[model samples]
Target: MEFRQDINGLRALAVLVVVLFHFGLAPVSGGFAGVDVFFVISGYLMTGIVFSRMEQGRFSLPDFWLARGRRILPALLAVCATLLLLGWFRLSPMDYKMLGKHALYSVTFLSNFIYQGESGYFDAASQDKWLLHTWSLSVEWQFYMLYPLWLLGARAVSRHPRAPVWAVWAAFAASLAASAVWTTRAPTQAYFQLAFRAWELLAGALVFLHAPRLQASPGQRSALALAGLAAIVCSCLHFTHDTPWPGMAALLPVGGAALVIAAARHGLWLTGNPVAQALGRWSYSIYLWHWPVWAALAYYGAHRQPAAIAAGIAASVVLGMLSFRLVEQPAARLLNRSGTRPRVALALSAACAAVLLPAGLVYVLHGVEQRLSPKVLAIAKEDGNRFKDRVACEFHPGAADPLPRCVLGDRKDVRLIVWGDSHASAVVTAVAEAVPHGVAYYGYQSCPTATGVHYRGWDNTCVAFNEAVLADMRALPPQAPVLIVNRFASYVFGKDAGNPEPVPGVVMDDEPQLSTRPELEAAYKRRLIGMLCRVRQTGREVFVLESLPEMTVYVPNHLARALLRGERPDDVKVSMADYRARNAVVGAWLQEARTTCGVRLLDPTPYLCADGWCGGSRRLQPLYFDTNHLSERGNRVLLPLFRQAFGGLGARKLAAQPAATGQGG
Candidate 1:
């Protein structure tokens, strides 16, 4: 097969967009389409190789696999080794364990499956993962493992000259149909799984199979090339993290890439340019190095700043260039020199095991905690246990009744009910410590205290859960106080309040349409007022905790890494101005409720935020686990405020009680 400068240029374009997107550059919000571009390119190139060889009756499975091994393994092994070395000293025990687990998956080409089981690619935590980008590589590798066999088999069995092409088209159609269905039903899995992604590669195969028949007049070629570029550019500009991906939305970039490949014979200057060729030569190495560089910067708290992004890109290019020259080319030449494919395969397999064994050990030994101080290790380990108590007290929508174990404090004299979402669950320990009598916790995942807010993603079970909590609250004693704590910013602003997903439903009361921000805000306020009025009518005193300052970064993880490096952990606190800005609408609604609905508002900001900074830790203990939820020890920081709010209930006498402790939910 002859080399195509235009195809190399497409590689350059794809890699550039992906790097830019990963850098948090604002202009290319849809830069994720770069992966789609790569998928198409891979499909076209690989199919071209297989089809041409098969047609000549010279297709060798071992030779093809060996070639692929040479192309992919060297750079990937180098990157994994480098990350493992870096992580050994810089990562906390838990982070190191996760890194090792991911590295093992990366070497085995199962990272996509592992990551799908763990988190969505666009999730905030994904930024911390050094091997996250390898999921795409894994998907491609899985496709390569089977695609050649399928093509060869089709050629052998079918009498039709274009049987292989027909087979590729059939697979493409079936995979495309699955992508459409699974993308809506299980987007994360669809995004990472081969079954849902094969159509993209098949699209490229179709382009290659039909290339000889795609002759065009110069004018038509120019128009087609321009249209292809436009399609790619538009998708890159318009798509976002929220976009349903690699399904219908993916067709734009896949078709565009296909068009570019089909029209490449006409000599599109931009696709054959020198700069494009250079980037294309280094594209694989660049993709391998960029993610870990970005992840390292984030670990050290440089995050999305211009300086950090610049440094990461510079490091990636330098490292990528070095790897291409010093590692990849040399390794490929050495592997190709071997006369037998079995020898090359054995050598590659041995090298892969050498890399994966230590990674497996790291996971088995739980990140080797002996490397860090117990104090630092403790903080790092605390993240896993943050939700323990909530898990115990969780109330389901259709359960028989509220479990007695859900009640905290003195269950014999239950006086208050803590009701809301996970935010309500988060402060259960502090609320338990502050009140003399028992407090029943009714924490349901993603269910807000506000009434009539419907999440498009949530089923009726969420609504039923909210109703169940309300019913329990009405059953409380007349004089008992009901403390309503939720991450109110989410409902009013329709933003993720450090939760992985958006709150399931939209506010549907005032504006059933829920069409605009103002309308959503108004709807949220009305729902909150109704919730407050209902609780008051039940004769329970209503106390609403003002929204806590939501940190933009996961504080504990950031602090853990910083502390491991002997940097000042306190430097990671959120600014009061930024916290207030994010919560402004929720703050206004809280004030309105206090003034108009006769609800007692408890503000923890004075303690949590001071001197222009909202603290993320106190006395070397992390205050919040992730971006917003208070840690077990961090929740104690608000105990004084809890005391003041419940003072009318004679909490002073209970102050002598030892602070309650329970496993995290």
Candidate 2:
């Protein structure tokens, strides 16, 4: 396939926006759409190569695959190996372990699946992820691995030259439809999986298949190129991370790339300029190197600031250029040498094994904790001490309920029903120890205890669990007390910007993504109050938890790092006034609810915050299991609040009760 300068310029544009978006350097919230652009460009070139070779009656699948391997593997292996080396010194044990796993996945081209599985509100943030950007490369590699076989299948079905063309278009439509449907239903899978993403690439194939018929005057070509550039730029500038990605909205960037490629205006200023051409030439390496640089800076807590962002961009570009010069060029030359396929393949395979063996060893050793100081390692070990037993107690869309878990005390009488999201689960033991009654914990991930609100994910619905809990409450005898614990501020304002985008919530049974909606706090308050009043009407005591102060970092890992750096772990604290200001809207609603619904409030501030600060750690002991969920020790501090709230409640009934029937936690 001949190189088109316009296409190179387009590559330059695509990588540039993606870089800027990640670093947050430009007004390009939609810069993520740039990957869609690259996908289209990839499809065009791939299809052109395969079809042209087939036309010449000399196309070999192995040769084609080898070419792709040579083009991709050398630089990929270089980056993975580099990260593995530096990650040992730079990352925490858990983070390094994660890198090892991610590196393994990236090497195997299965990172998309692994990353999809790891997606959650509770997982590590993007900047904490070194190879997070590799998921796209994984997707592309999967596409490469499969697309030729699909073409071969199409060719096998028909002798006509146009068979694969028709087949690809059909597949393009199906992929697009799957992307649209799943973008709403299963966003994580839709966003990361090749099935949903293949259409964007196929759009490029269709453009290549039909480019011959797109004849136009040079002026018309220029206009079309400009329009395509505008569309791509608009998507970057207009859309945000919260946008349902790779849905129908992705067509803007995909189509724009296809149009620019189809226009074939090699000298157009937008794409064919000197800078664009240079960036284009180094695009793959630039894409590969930029993320780890950003991730490293992000891990150090300095990224997204002006100096850091500028330094990161400069570092990424320089590293990319060096990688191109030293690694990609040398590998290309070696592979292009006469009859070097076997040696090249063998060498690349050896390189992969070299990376895989250590990465696997690192993962097996759990990030090799022996390297850390004893104190930091102890802090690292505290991370997995979640308050609740996740396997049996936690509820997700399809999580198994093999036991009567979350029943913290005697099962004879479930005197108290503790309900909310995961935040509720975090403090269930504290409530259990404080009360004499059998505590039935009804905690679901992401499902806050509000009647008119719905959390978008969690396998599409949180309806059945909440409803069942409510029904159980109604069936209970009068004067049954219920405690609701939720981290309210997250849904309203979102976690600190670098964390996963805030949970997309449907408030008042209306629009989703509450943070974007108008008067969301007020709506959430109405729904919450209504639910509390309804419970009260059923002769149940409704106790709602005041907002738990959100943490700026993962407390355990932050403390461990502080220890590792010999910095004071106590320095990592949330401001007391800031916490109040952050939760002002929810606070107002809580005040109104106390009068309107007579709900009892249990404030954590009195127990957790003091001296104008809310400690993420308690005197070197970590309080949080993650950014927001409390560890067992962390929630134990709130025992006083729970005892006070449940102190005046009547004793449990001693009447014969239903047998505790399931497996125990």
**TM-score for all predictions?**
0.83, 0.88
User: What value does the lDDT take at residue 500 in candidate 2?
Assistant: 34
Query: What lDDT tens digits, residue by residue, belong to model 2 across residues 221-246?
Result: 99889999999999999988778888
Candidate of highest lDDT: 2
Q: Mind giving the per-residue lDDT tens digits that candidate 1 earns over 1-665? A: 78888788889889989988888888899999999999999999999899888888898887887788889998899889888888888888778899999999999899998999876567667877889999999999999999998877887899798888888988999999999999988888899999999999998899888876976887787788778878998888999988998889999999998888888744777777777788889999999998888887777768668888898888988888899999999998888787687788888998898889989988998888788887788777666546465665776555554432367766545667788777887788788888777777777766677676655445545556666566654445556678988887765544454452343236463355566666666676788788787777776678998888887676766667778899865644778887777678678777877787688888888989889998877665678887778888778888999887874574423222233222122
Residue 28, model 2: Cα distance from true site in angstroms: 4.2
| lDDT of model number 1 | 0.79
Worst 10 residues of 1 by lDDT: 655-664
Q: Quickly count the clashes in candidate 1.
A: 13
Q: What lDDT would each prediction earn against the true structure? A: 0.79, 0.81
lDDT of 2: 0.81
RMSD of 2: 3.7
Error of 2 at 572 (Å): 2.7
Every model: Cα RMSD to truth: 5.1, 3.7
